[model samples]
Target chain A: MAANSRFAVAAHVLSLLHIHEGGRITSEYIAGSVNTNPVVVRRIMGMLNKAGLVQTSPGVAGATLARPIDEITLLDVYRAVQPEDGSLFAIHDNPNPDCRVGRNIQVTLDTAFTRAQQAMERELAGMTMEEVCLDIVNRP
Target chain B: MAANSRFAVAAHVLSLLHIHEGGRITSEYIAGSVNTNPVVVRRIMGMLNKAGLVQTSPGVAGATLARPIDEITLLDVYRAVQPEDGSLFAIHDNPNPDCRVGRNIQVTLDTAFTRAQQAMERELAGMTMEEVCLDIVNRP
Candidate 1:
């Protein structure tokens, strides 16, 4: 499977929103910054809205952060945009039951994968949209 | 993109090798246990070999661990199978530089992502093939 870029794209979207807070920026504009399509932005926006990270009003042309930029962590955005349970690792569902490794692979992998995911989330939780926006404005 | 299954697949290969050490196990057999293709298994094996985690010899139908399972960490398997610098997260190459957020996004993302990758590796480094194999055999 190809690597999913949703996390990067979603973080990009949030940073843009943080930089342009109080302004009505369309998904097309966000897509332009993200170098992707408005449809993709909208799909991600829909997920973000559902997760309450961002909100879209019926009359609004674009979305806005539901809370302050500093209040939203990358982990929040990650969870918002991620599909399913959003586990970064996946164990093959069916393995040869007769093989000892195959029979126990899922449980063993799941334990390790769960820990890796939590570790990743901890790292992400330390970063916020405000921090990203600040880094952009301060970049050399 | 779908989540990559290389970690689980590689670990599965390692465990099977551990359980049947000194015996030749074909890629076909490993694929059967993984429920993936022999080509997929071979591809992973190639990476493992390059990492010096596994050894392949002439006339041998299968590969074996280069080190004891207790000495091989999940981090080793992960590094073996990952492409490029093996960073778990990737920032898109082209973000709209005209936008403040876009201009600095990559650097900002790289910093966060690098930390996330380190955290994940730390978690993986704590586990070993021996532990995984034990989990398998102990399962009801």
Candidate 2:
């Protein structure tokens, strides 16, 4: 199965908004850059809108970043596009309680998984959309 | 979609083997502990086997750890069950080259995503099956 690409697409959309700041940038325009369907871009925009990362109107042809690009971290974008649960790893369901290992493995894995997830999130938190846009603009 | 549970299941299977070290612990027995189908257990066992983490034979009812549990890190188990590509994040495909951001967003995202993925992996690498088993054994 394809890994989820919502985070990447969201970043792309936001970068485009920053690059074209002050211009009316439609979902169709964003989709063209992302090489995805406009509907996909709109759906992500809705999530970004709800997250307060972007501003959109019911019939508007364009969206804008709600905050300065420097204020939005990749973590914010990642969380906005991901499910609220947002766990990086999934523990198995319903281990046999009668088994000692099964009875406690979930909690054990949870502790370890949480650490790993936080480590990743910390890296994301350190990177802002401003940096991403800068990297894009500076790239050859 | 449910987060992939193969990592949890693989860990469970390995823990079972460690707990029942000397006995002929069949796939059905491991499945009982995991509360999943025997086929599921066998399928993961196949992956663990191919990863050289376990020793299994055709028509065998049980498997054994290929190395000491202390030597098997969660990262090892994680990589064993994950796809060869094994990137934690997926960048969207085919951005429009005509667009400046599109031409460079992938490379920028790749750098950031790699850092996040590596941070998570390093945490996993720090944890071994021994610690997990110990955690399970010590749980009240």
Candidate of highest lDDT: 2
Best by TM-score: 2
lDDT of each: 0.85, 0.93
Local error of candidate 1 at residue A90 (angstroms):
1.9
| Stretches of model 2 off by over 4 angstroms after superposition | none
Please write out the lDDT profile of model 2 over residues A18-80, one tens digit for every residue: 999999988898999999999999999999999999999988777888999999999999999
Off by over 4 Å in 1: B1-3
Instruction: Write down the worst ten-residue block by lDDT for model 1 chain A.
Output: A1-10
Q: Please tell me what DockQ candidate 2 reaches.
A: 0.88
Whose DockQ is greatest here? Answer: 2
Looking at model 1 chain B, which ten-residue stretch has the lowest summed lDDT?
Answer: B84-93
